[model samples]
Target: MTITTTLEPVTGPFVWRGDELSRTDDWIFRLGPDQVAELEEVGRRFIADDPDLRTVSAAQYPLTAAAEAIRRFGADMDSGRGFVLIRGLRMEEYDDTLAAAIFYLIGLHLGEPIRQNELGDLIDHIVGVSDKAYEEGGLPSRTRDKLPYHSDSSDAVALMCLRPPASGGLSSLVSGATVFNELLARRPDLAPLLLEPWHYDWRRQDPDAPADTYTSPIVSWTQGCFSMYAGADMIESAHRYPGVPPLTGPQREALALIEEITYSDGVALDMDFQPGDIQWLLNYAALHSRTEFVNGADFAHTRHLLRLWLRRDVGRPLVENFGKHVVVDRSSTRTEDAVRDTQGHFRIREAAAVRTDWGD
Candidate 1:
């Protein structure tokens, strides 16, 4: 793998500061009334047909009313800002099943949804089922702990807010390019270390995996394009397993500086999620985080978000081993015959109680 150094700062539409972005509403795309009606009609039809999700395609459910808008959203994520917030779904009109169908329909237009877990689930639920931390054996998706800024294992990631928590649970995102440019300017010595191979815990993603850990560089530059894959918690946790080397002093300092840059003022953009709002992000261009939240006792009122990891039809170049952990299969071979329950809804509560797949 040839890792070239670029001391010159990366300048593009993707390199945006949060404080500057917050002052403008340009990143948000609101659905019009005609579009919402078209979505509702198609969503209900999808639930009625009940086709196998594994084989469904964008061609099967055409969204003529919103096709142009969806295409723009895709362009914005890929070439503009690396992220977009789509609002105005009118959540009160539909139940969980219909809501999921709408989210899935839009996702199909954007990209192919990949399996999110060993269960081969295309959609993963983000809800706090337990109060314990992930380090204590609890799943991060099922806990209320604050998640650190990290990239998921896919070309892009989309989240649809079905229910907002009663208290705090703001979703935040930081530009990986912006962070890298700042680091290069402030700590040039540490920037090169991110290109070196680093060990990360694999048991966190799958308990029964053949290997306990996997290796990858935090940053990669190829063909004049830059990509990033980061999760400091996973890098630090790799120390628990045997055969993995300990992090050197400079390596530790590099990790610290990266985190400091992400948390610095104007670096991370915070989004107060609203019901029916969906946020799409390019995984290589952005790292996302969430604040700890409080949920009500009622399961019906609990905070719930649907997550989809997509393999884009259009993608950027990457160096070798930069993102080897996530296997983006065209179709899942390990999923259950039926991912949803008899009531035509995903059994999120039951799945959360027993699921072991955990990552940011």
Candidate 2:
């Protein structure tokens, strides 16, 4: 698909103003030298105090301090800059388990903490990396590779870089609001089509359940706020199931326009991640992507990152058609039935969850 919309250059800092977007310094925050040092020290000690850290599978931290940092740094959906990419944090120095633990700790400090078990389930759903594969591969394919632009089940999402790609893996971000604004200005007639629900193919399904597809709006507005979830492959897959509507020509046009706007310099921000860097974003507010990359030949040198999907207690409501599967309780787990073939370069293994060496 091709986008025909002409776009204006993005100026000013990216800021979220209600449901709209603008550029402003108020929404952007950077950690100072002292804070960065404090964070590193805290991370180091957390690993040291819990020597079985790699085996440990629980969230252990002071909630007040973590919440304070999140509030101060503007880590909410309404805060509009939508994303923050922290550089200089390296994950390779620690073991995979410790690396994941560190990510969990820092993420807990950033938002309302969810249990490790719940986190584990969510991770399994998002990445589908089983316990055995985690032991062997060290991480899942979705995370180990350059993840495409997609939103996870959260108001805010974060990733801590443990081991970065040896070469050619850069993080990219685009504002959904920016794309909508560009569309509203350039192609007013197609704007409303995006506000309606579109089908999504849930590729990561369990074996027992029937193959099912879900529907969600690519763009939606509620209480004067807007949210979105747009992915080319996922949206196209929805039609495979019975009773789902096909993509309309205008919807296709709008999606193509969105791709153009997001990839263009006018709406996108690109950065190369360094080891130890932590990147977080308001998932509903921003669309993110990564460039394809190659891991080093050695297992020790392979690229790895830890991810967390956080529900912002203070976040806005999802449009009615979106968020159908977003159950509030942490215990809910829905499996998909999409089959996997071994044709790709990478291999995917199916295994059950295992008890971590670190006791809960």
TM-score of each candidate structure, all chains considered together: 0.90, 0.70
Clashes of each: 0, 14
Q: On residues 113-134, what C-alpha lDDT tens digit does candidate 2 reach at each position?
A: 3322322333321232233332
Give the lowest summed-lDDT range of ten residues in model 1: 340-349
- For 27-145, candidate 1 gives per-residue lDDT tens digits of 99999999999999998888777766767888999999999999999998888889999998999887777888888889889988776655466777888877567768666678787
Q: After superposition, how far is residue 92 of candidate 2 from its true place, in Å?
A: 6.3
Which of the numbered candidates is closest to the native, going by highest TM-score? 1
The superposed Cα distance between candidate 1 and the true structure at residue 82, in angstroms, equals: 0.4
Over all chains combined, what TM-score does candidate 2 have?
Answer: 0.70
The Cα local distance difference test for each model comes to 0.80, 0.53
Winner by lDDT: 1
